[model samples]
Target: MVPEAQLRDDGAGLAPASAGWFVLNARDARWFHRPGRGDSVPLTGCDELEAETYFPMLGMSIQVLPPGEPNATYHWETEQEDFLVLAGRALLVVEGQGRQLEQWDFVHCPPETRHAFVGVGDEPCVILAASSRQFQKDGPWGFYCADEIARRYNASAPEDTQDGDVAYGRFPPSRPTRYRDGLLPD
Candidate 1:
């Protein structure tokens, strides 16, 4: 459980009654960015300061993608994942198909579903992502074909490369963001 000192009155730190459970409001959550991966604010129910083992059961995060920016490469995971569009608009690239998404749109991605997202329009697209944490025997993560749809938005992996082989050295390290106001829906 999170310590009393970390608890806040505005529902920023109200968590479940579990060993590592904790909470944080959108305004107070710390935001991070990975060079090519994009920006996100983790909404895990655990101490954010404790990076390694904060969330044990599932993983949750709010991803913010600017125009033409992508949340990640074209890939799928062994575990199921879901996404909710909170504000702005985006293009969902899944299984070589492209679908435009708007606020309140929910996407359900079953295991081994190839997918990625790219921000569209002038404003930033905010998405809430949730995924199962059940470990797999052959690893839960994998990258797939680089499609034309993903290439349009610069979200595709390098040509003729597999997962873990793509270089991210050109991208910037993930870091915290100061734009807390953007966390909320417009």
Candidate 2:
């Protein structure tokens, strides 16, 4: 069970109220929605954890992407990242190559490996992502995608894009989704 004080219900979503150790079932995890992106349930182990701080060593999350929706702009990170497909199907674009990913498929992305994913079937694709946050002094960097294939899903970087700042600006602020009652299976 999740403590009442640990979850802040601000109408948009449930966020951690403070920094500390906490436990909640996957179905009970807080889901945050990104307007143009999709929904993600961050498993940071603490509410006070920031994206820049690489304390937990492994940053994890469960993301749900609707068909044609891309998780994020095509980019690679300085740290290694791995992914496991939990449900549905998705198209994985890595290092300029595209691969069909099905349930139970696992993906390992080395450092500085460019990759992105898009839901392909009628149903939403669910993915479990884990990344090594160790030695992340400067975080990750976003890559510009000029490929026409990726552009079809709005996953490509804008023309003359300089960095992630330019790509992220195209999307709206993130909102929250109900993981327990919405996406998770009983």
Candidate 3:
């Protein structure tokens, strides 16, 4: 049966029901804000979707990063992850190597491929990131790594660890936020 779509906003932002199926512009999707790191919108409507109704196989989101800001600590997951640069420029640090990416560049990280991204250039870098979730929790889902290159961008874990709290200890907790005009490049 198709789950009915609904809307919710608990002073955070509007998260339209996405179970079964739902349609909404990215600008109307629920977003989150991390201090220093830019805003992000989980395209799957994860904010309001019930746990039992969550997508069983995949997770997706769009990350907006300001210049010199990194999307996350350098890490690798048990599941494959993929990304597409939608706008602006970004520096991709993968497997201890650095690569410059531009609009439309695509990246596919096989399971356990260490990687992270930092925004570059004058404008905010936008990336569409997606990952598989099935079997992710069957074992350790992720492992943060310590790398000199990632460290240069402040995106490396202080030391190797599988604990998320320890790996992300330096960053502030993210808060739910609403989308605003000009957040995305036209």
Candidate 4:
């Protein structure tokens, strides 16, 4: 017998709680917002969803970044990560260099290649970001870089620490938010 698909509301938003396959509209997806930054829609399950489980092989999310805000601090992982610009414009800082990316631009970062993205242009930038979740013997291999260019965008770690609290100390924890209209381009 197949499991029935259902959406469960954990006081935040409706999220898939079934064991089988399901479909959900982006406009109705669960979202979270970080103060002073922007919002993110986790296509899979995020901690905010109260699923207590993450994708075993790969994790994917849609990042909605407002101008002058960054998706994350400059960092690199032990596994490959890829990103595709879906709308608007963004500035990509990779390996101590900066490049402007427009719609449909794709970026692939091999393991240990430091990179970060800052929303540019006049509107919010949308990005589809994915990363491998396979861990190594030493655990999730990753490091935050203290790049000068990243600092200008407020997207750099303070002292090259692996602790997320140190890297994102200035920002508040993300709060549960519902997907609102006009967050994505038509």
Instruction: List, in order, the clash count of every candidate structure.
Output: 5, 1, 0, 0
Quantify all predictions' global Cα lDDT against the true fold.
0.71, 0.73, 0.86, 0.85
Q: Judging by TM-score, tell me the better candidate of 3 and 4.
A: 3
Ranking 1 against 2 by lDDT, winner: 2
lDDT top scorer: 3
Expressed as tens digits, the lDDT of each residue in 1-186 for candidate 3 is 887777666576666554556666788777889776788988654532452265657878999999999999999999989999999999999999999999999999999999999999999999999988876658778799999999999899999999889988998998888897887888
How does residue 78 of candidate 1 score in lDDT? 78
In candidate 1, what are the lDDT values of residues 1-186, reduced to their tens digit? 446334333233333333443545666555566666667766764343342255555778888888888887777777889999989999999998999999999999998898999989988898999987676335634555567888787777666345444624335666555445654665
Worst 10 residues of 2 by lDDT: 46-55
Arrange candidates by TM-score, descending. 3, 4, 2, 1
Give the local distance difference test score of model 1. 0.71
TM-score winner:
3
Across 1-186, the per-residue lDDT of candidate 4 in tens digits comes to: 766667776565667776555677777788899875688987777853333343466768899999999999899999899999999999999999999999999999999999999999999999999977776335666998899999999999998988989999999999888878899887
Displacement of the residue 131 alpha carbon in candidate 3, Å: 0.7
Error of 2 at 66 (Å): 0.7
Ranked by lDDT from best down, the candidates are 3, 4, 2, 1
Model 1 CA deviation exceeding 4 Å by range? 1-19, 35-37, 45-52, 136-140, 160-162, 165-170
User: Which scores greater on TM-score, model 1 or model 4?
Assistant: 4
Per-residue lDDT tens digits of candidate 2, residues 1-186?
A: 533446565454455565455556666566787777778888763332554442356778888888888997877777889999999999998877789999999999998787889988988899999987776655434345555666777877775354757777778878665664556433
Higher TM-score: candidate 1 or 2? Answer: 2
